[model samples]
Target: MMMLNIDDSGMARPYLRENIVFNHAHTEISTGTTLFACQFDGGVVIGADSRTSSGTYVVNRVTDKLTPLAKGIFCCRSGSAADTQKVADIVRYQLDFHRMQMDRDPTVLEAAVACRSICYAYRDDLTVGLFVAGWDESLGGQIYSIPLGGMLLRQPAVTGGSGSTYIYGYFDREFRSGMTKEECAKFVSTGVALAINRDGSSGGCVRLAIISKDGVERRLIKGDCVPRFSIC
Candidate 1:
């Protein structure tokens, strides 16, 4: 099977669009909705749609893709839910061990690197895309994108999953550095809302989290109310 490569647009090239063609187990690659993270003045905001699918069939409508790995640290999974959950568990254990060994909290960058190393080692066997976000005393807030094959990247804003292709333009036009937490929350919520409306693989509810100096705060944006954006 040919390894998948995500193009600049965040879409897998046509050859890899449906991982099903490569192998049966890889079918979960087509199940993504959208998961993204962005920086704000006070912290970072991470959001994801709740839909989980297998090909055209919806498997779960209330999946919480955004997971708290630790206090002030969160990860949003976008590919194979089982694979992502396994990796998240491994990374969470490592983070806890590191803190106990070193007597301090791990920084966002440290956690990303650790997670990437693990993902890279298992790249041939696992399919997963992740967005890591957190705040620390030294770095107020940050977000990282970790795609399959373990490409780790730091971005002010990033979107992953199938719905990402539909909403990239909205983020490109409205994103600005130094946005307040409130502004970032609204922007991310709106982006997920739009993605859910237009992308079949994306729907259900919008799960959001804000990671600040204190810790991570979570919220849920109802899917039924998202259509209001069509008028606004």
Candidate 2:
């Protein structure tokens, strides 16, 4: 039996379920998620494809990993199962708390703080890689990313495991200025295709969510042409 390495970013482990465990316990499988965010005049476009795998086993396919955090704020994650679940719970709690205390809706900045707090608390136990999108008050449309160390970035980003290369390239070319949300939707569809075709660790279903100044809307676009994410 052997113990594996663990860190704030992520860890590598070998299978030894009975006699030993990696990180904290059993291996959580090499899974990942990729989220693409674009800042447009009208709103933010977030397209995430569902593809979770464990070694040779396709654990979950066509899953919904992207969700709306606030009215116009959306989040997408691809990383440790532990971190994902934890962040989600914290965000939910924060939103609930804010509603109870202020009697007002939580904003994107607040949501980011909630997420960062979780990362700081269990900074040693989780690998939280996430992207946050919304209409920035000053910048109009804004896209931000928070990786392991709470580093925020805005660059038409990508987050996930092995299949990142394929998806990142696809996003870079298709993403540009003045593209409509609909066009970005198509671009995301293409990105999903590239990930499914090239990355073995991802691809079962696709979930797409878009957010605007008005609100957030999601749909599952799995058809002959592309995979769906949320709404059926």
Best by TM-score: 1
In the range 1-232, model 2's lDDT, one tens digit per residue, is 6667554467766445653433423457434755666666677777666766554555677667775676567777778665686687678777878878998777676777778777767777778777777664545566667777776656643544455676675566666788887887666656765676666666655666667766666767663556433323
- Tens digits of lDDT, candidate 1, 158-189: 98898999888998999999888889999899
Candidate 2 Cα RMSD after full superposition onto the native fold (Å): 8.3
Candidate 1 stretches with Cα past 4 Å from truth are 1-31, 228-232
Highest lDDT scorer:
1
Model 1, residue 50: C-alpha shift (Å): 0.4
Least well predicted 10-residue stretch by lDDT in candidate 1: 16-25
In candidate 2, position 164 carries an lDDT of: 63
